[model samples]
Target chain A: MIRRRKIAEALFKLLSLSALALAIGTLVLLFGALMVDGLGRLDWQFLTSFPSRRASQAGILPAMVGSTLVMLVTACVGIPIGVAAGIYLEEYARRTWLTELIEVTVTNLAGVPSIIFGLLALGLFVYTLGLGPSILTAGLTLALLILPVVIVTTREAIRAIPVHIREAAFALGATKWQTVSDHVLPYSAAGILTGVILALSRAIGETAPIVTIGALTFIAFLPPAPVTSQPPYVSFEWLMSPFTVVPIQMFAWVSRPGEDFAANAAAAGLLLVGMTLVMNGLAIYVRYRMRKRVSW
Target chain B: MEIRETVSISHSSVMESASHRRARRRREFLIEGALLLAALVSVAATITILFVLVFESVGFFETVPLLDFLTDTLWTPLFDDPHYGILPLLAGTIVTSVVGLVVAIPVGTVSAVYLSEFASARLREIIKPVLEMLGAVPTVVYGYFALLVVTPALQWIWPELPGFNMLGPGVVIGIMILPLVISLSEDAMRAVPMMLREGSYAMGATRLQTAWRVVVPAATSGIVAAYVLGISRAVGETMVVAIAAGQNPNLTWNPMEPAATITAYIVQVALGDLPHGSIGYQSIFAAGLVLAVMTFAFNIVGHLMRKRFREVY
Candidate 1:
């Protein structure tokens, strides 16, 4: 009986270790395969030129530019609103049924599938509001998609500020807004910034919601220049211009038949994966450094 | 003389005038109002999503009978002679999700157990980020990997496996959701208090026995919540199935067959040039509503489970 029990324990340990190994091994395999297939395709030409009928001539220029512009809009619109909401929830709102309802709604929104967001954008933005599948619509769709993440992270960061700190500010004749802005916001900025970066990273790789809003898969030209030598140096024309993002571009290539297009898809995937990993790495590093510095 | 001059510095000048005080109060009030509006955006978003889905689906259900939508097996909204049965898509979703869960649950659970109960803290810190990276990888990339890599791999084991079978995407999804399951389950297991394990050890139980019998049972509700969330994720996953599983709406449970999930169908219709307000376009909203309802139900159950079992120690 003792021997049997010992053997069972050893077997269970082996099972557990192998389970972890399997997960790590898969990640290694994925990166290795992408490198082997796509490394040679990464070049200045590939970065600068427009996608072509011939797979060798194709580039990610238009797609990359569109992604950047869309991200700009998403950041501008999403971050301030998300941060304010977070501030309201953590710093100001009293515990009440209405706050509880909002909390539940936010949680539920976070779980709603990305594709559903796409459907919402289609009905609301594209048709009802007549945004017409522009970068603005895609940005708004993704802004809503990332709002819950931002809010949750912001709230957590604010909550981490010690109550004594807030009390001290209050005793110093600081109003609620003054305490939050001067104490809470500054203290939590690192955490909130990390969350923002992570959220943007997630949004960057999103394809379904963007695709559902009917992002064009093929675009040979970039949007109207955001900065130009013309009378008004900055332009809003790009917001309404048709756009294609990297993931959608990759998807288009992957669906087509041929080894050449497959290679291109692999190359695009490498770039997308690399970007998200870097952002995640940065977020982790920021959190680690902040935790080391702050005891309370 | 200098001390008297300093002492006599005007107190009234230092204090804010009534107008200034009122202005500051007004500013505070405006800021609060703005912040409240920002918080309400989430509520508005929820309401708008519901309205959009239901409104379009209402238009769709008007033409297609509700009974046929539920009971019929076919789903060909784009065909010349259209059928709006959602079962085929639903079947596809169930099959793939089941296959994914089969692979994920055991492996993820084991990994969680190891991380929470067995591994050293330093080892856990390293492993945790790597697992998070797996979740962070783009789904589009996973879709590509599923189509180009995993499917070819399965063909070696099963010679008759088609180019676009559900098995490849299902397995990849299992890998995709593995991190989620591991992290959430590990959190649950770790929350099982240390005294319970001590009690088991005092009773002459081995570490494995202690974890299996004591901690696992204690954290059962949380683990179940993790599983439910994983199921919701698998069901809603779009790109992997879209790229690997063929877009045919086949009503079968076989993992070896090609089929379209509800999400994949929505993508297909969106990619096409279906006119706005047409039956084909309207059909996607109907499909989306069903998808939303299913995931929403799972999420609520998971939420309740977590809430009910929290802080049990």
Candidate 2:
């Protein structure tokens, strides 16, 4: 019986080691496949060109530009409301029933499926509001998707500020606005920025929500540039322009029935993986810097 | 000279004090109100999602009897003779989710055990972030990986395997949610007080024996919570299943067969152009409603388990 017990323990340890190995091995193999199939395809022309009938001629410029524009709008809309909500929950709201309700609601929202958010946006923004399938519509939908993330992260950052700092500000006769804006927010800016950037990266990787919003799958033309001449030198028309993003483009390629399309899909996935890694790496580095600077 | 300057400063402050205080107070009220409104947007979003789903789904049910929608075996909303039965899709979802859980639970829990109990701090730090990075890799990329890698590998071993089988997507999703399970379960294991392990050691328990018996039992609630959350994610996952699991809604118990999950159906319909307010378009909303309720139920169960069993220390 003692010998059997010892053998069982050894087997369990081996199983545990293999489990970790399986995860890392799978990731390494996935990266290897992507690099082997995709790296040669990525070039200046591939980045600059638009979708083509022939897979070899296709470029991802429009999708890249569209994704950037969407991210810009999403950041602009999501960050302020999300940060304010975080500030309200952490610093301003007293322990009340209403505050608890908001807290619960945000937590639940974080768990709601991204596709449901898409369905809501389809009904509300596309049909009811007549935003059509424009970048603005997709941007607004993504904003809702990432709001809970931003709020949660921002709240954590703000909560980390020492209580003594707030007390010190109060003792000096500074009003709540002055105290938060002048001191608390500035001190927590690095942390909050890190959170915001990470949230945006997640937003970029999301495909289903945008897909459900009826974003044009094939686009040969770019959204009118943010700077175009008509009356004003700057143009807001691009917000209303129909667009396709990188993940959507990748999905389109993957769905097609041919080897070339498969290669194209692999290439697009490689670009997306690169973007996600870079963004996440930046977030980590910023967080590391902040952690190093503040002993508290 | 300092006293004179202080008095002058005080006099100037007093001269502006009443109006300045009033302005500051007004500004505070406005900003507070605005912030409160901003916080309420999440609540508003929840209400909007629920309201839109129910309202649109009601329209769908009016066209197709609610009983038929629930009980029928087929889901062909786009065909000439449309059958709105959601059972096939639900079955597909359940099978794939079960397959995913089968892969994720054991692997994730074992890894968590290894990391929490045996690994040194330095190794733990390096591995944890890599696990997180694994999780954060986009689902679309996972879809590509599932289609190009797992499916082919399976076919090479078993020539009878279908091109777009549930098994492939299910396994990929399991890998995708592994980070979530490891992180959450590891937290639970770590939460099991060190004293428990020491007590087991005092009784001549080996390291494996202490972890398997004492710590595992102590951390059961957290492990259960993590599994529940992982299951919820598997059920809601869209892209991987959509791309790899074939679009045909086949009602079968076999994971090797092609099947359409509820999410896959939603993506299928949305990818095409259906006229707004049509029954076909509303059907996706109906499917969305079902998906929402399914995930929400899982989340509530997980929340309850955590609340009941969470270790305070």
Clashes per candidate (backbone, < 3 Å): 0, 0
Considering summed lDDT, which 10 consecutive residues are worst modelled in model 2 chain B?
Answer: B304-313
What is each candidate's fraction of native interface contacts (fnat)? 0.82, 0.75
* Model 1 CA lDDT for position B252: 98
Locate the minimum summed-lDDT window of 10 residues in model 2 chain A. Answer: A224-233
**Per-residue lDDT of candidate 2, residues A1-296 (tens digit):** 77887998889878987998889998898899888878888888889999999999999999999999999889989999999999999989999999989998897888888888889999999999999988999899999888998999899999899989989999999899889999889889889988888888889989988999988878999888777666677989999999999999999999898888888888898999899889899999999999999865
Instruction: Output the worst ten-in-a-row residue range by lDDT, candidate 1 chain B.
Output: B8-17
Candidate 1 structure, TM-score to reference: 0.97
What is model 1's DockQ versus the real complex?
A: 0.85
Q: What TM-score does the first chain of candidate 1 have? A: 0.98
Clashing pairs in 1: none
Clashing pairs in 2: none
Taking chain A of candidate 2, what TM-score results? Answer: 0.96
Task: Report the lDDT tens digits of candidate 1 across residue range B219-248.
Answer: 999999999999999999999999999999
